[model samples]
Target: MGETNDVTALVAEVEEQERELVLTRFTHDDAWQLGCLLVELAVERRLAVTVDVRKGPQQVFHAALEGTTPDNDSWVQRKVRVVERFGASSFLTGLRARAKGQDFNAQHQLPLQEFAAHGGAFPVRVAGVGIVGVVTVSGLPQAEDHALVVEALRIHAAGGA
Candidate 1:
């Protein structure tokens, strides 16, 4: 790590760019699940979560994953933290912007919702219906974080929900 920038910001930016690149198109259903799964993966790993998908330049799609028995304060904070740090501009990309009428080919690609102290995110691609996005997971150890997202995607794909 040799540079003149805040490491966290740098990492976030990189993740944001990569995510934007993956989302080559946009689909309403796919966008919703992407955010939902991001939260699901976070809770699975006992981490808090919130996620959003953007279409075009300024459209924002957001969702929060809740914990059992009503509300999870920590999870709420996680959503708040992520939203505070990475908003639509920083996270949503041009692909999603351009995917308006096109058919997004990426199926149900997801992003790691957790931010790790070490940095690095799991980038998955959902290419099928003019929609694409990265499954970014962090907070937990690298492999563990990675697994959390991958597994979630698999489950969703299998369930067809």
Candidate 2:
């Protein structure tokens, strides 16, 4: 919840973060590494969630942590759909719409049944290429979910475990 300008700034910041946080190479190993990092972070924080890394429609890695349910998995799908459709982070997409005094469903005429502009999913971009996948977390507050994924991506981008 922010002012219009704040939301606009958030979208810009996320876009810059995504633009800079690209992988030199993205293999199955990279996906596994990123996915595992999300799970580990969630566990350490006692968060009940589902984390998924997917290439297009193919899930590369996924885990439902303790206390998570099937509903969280559905959230992952919804959030990822926003990222896939917009080619941006779900949080950013949501913020952009909000800044325009609209939501994705109302502004874009997208179905809420099919898409969610939640803040948990981010595009997985590879250097010199465009977004090839999405990494998502669900079950926490939207900002927390988004932060967890972004932090993991940052660590991965910096070549950390």
Candidate 3:
């Protein structure tokens, strides 16, 4: 059910943000590397960073440790409903708040203790179209995790459509 419109919008957004060299981060090949790096940082700082990626409502991906989860960890079916209801705006706002320390969810894994502790997540959209997926990272301070995910998304989005 991936809408062509949403995918297109996401592609456009990726292109626009790709130029923000400061935002680009790790690639698919570096997912584990990024996780390790985040974990190291979390160990140093003593914080947790648990996160997830949602496509509309369905959580397409998630990275967490044992016994940790999100505040709104709804079932995939319900997640789809959430996506349709909230659109990308609400989803991104929630993810950003988690990264910014505004809406801390202690239920999720902590950075140092978790494989990858602290990180960030963002709505993946095609500029002219709409949201297609979500990118999230964890294993360091929320700020650092966010920076990495932003950069990685920009870098990864560049070659994708």
Candidate 4:
């Protein structure tokens, strides 16, 4: 079915993004760089956006571009919760739940007030270790949100500065 294929492709994309977007080491400096890149890309795209990078409970870098509201910040929090809980991209969590014919909320029982399975948050994975932090962007369409994060991470991984 079309929906099945779409889910499959989405899952593939999530996996590919995870595979390619890796950090040798994630530090406060790296978080700042990634967050600034997210803001720059959002500005270039004319998108009202908020970016958050966190290592556990410590906030590393956070920014809200022009046109973004407090709600965008809230979404960033929620989406990052998804990445924190799932150890995967928020988009992947949603797509995997859909593929299983279950709603993410129903399956996870995580409060909507604190968690979202929307796109734009990715686990900050370090090679040979695991997820160390999260990088999140909010205020775009779900797919576009996911794409923007992936692109920024790709650039960061490729030594863009």
What is the total number of backbone clashes in candidate 4?
A: 0
| lDDT tens digits, residue span 1-161, model 1 | 33324434544554554454443344666556755776765666667443444443232445444533223223333333333344422122212322332221222232224321111223334455432333443344433444454455555555533
Clashes of each: 26, 0, 29, 0
> How do these models rank on TM-score, best leading?
4, 2, 3, 1
Which digits, one per residue and each the tens of the lDDT, describe model 4 over residues 15-98?
887888878988888888988998898888799888888876689999988888999989998998888878899999999999
Clash count (model 2, backbone only): 0
1 or 4, greater by lDDT = 4
Cα distance off (Å), candidate 4, residue 108:
1.5
Among these predictions, the greatest lDDT belongs to: 2
Position 22, candidate 4: lDDT: 79
lDDT of 3 by residue, 38-112 (tens): 444444555554545554445544555434345323222232333344443223433433444454234232231
lDDT of 4: 0.88
Q: How accurate is candidate 3 locally (lDDT)?
A: 0.43
RMSD in order of candidates: 12.7, 1.5, 12.6, 1.1
TM-score of each: 0.37, 0.95, 0.38, 0.95
Residue pairs in clash, model 2: none
Residue-level lDDT for 113 in candidate 4: 78
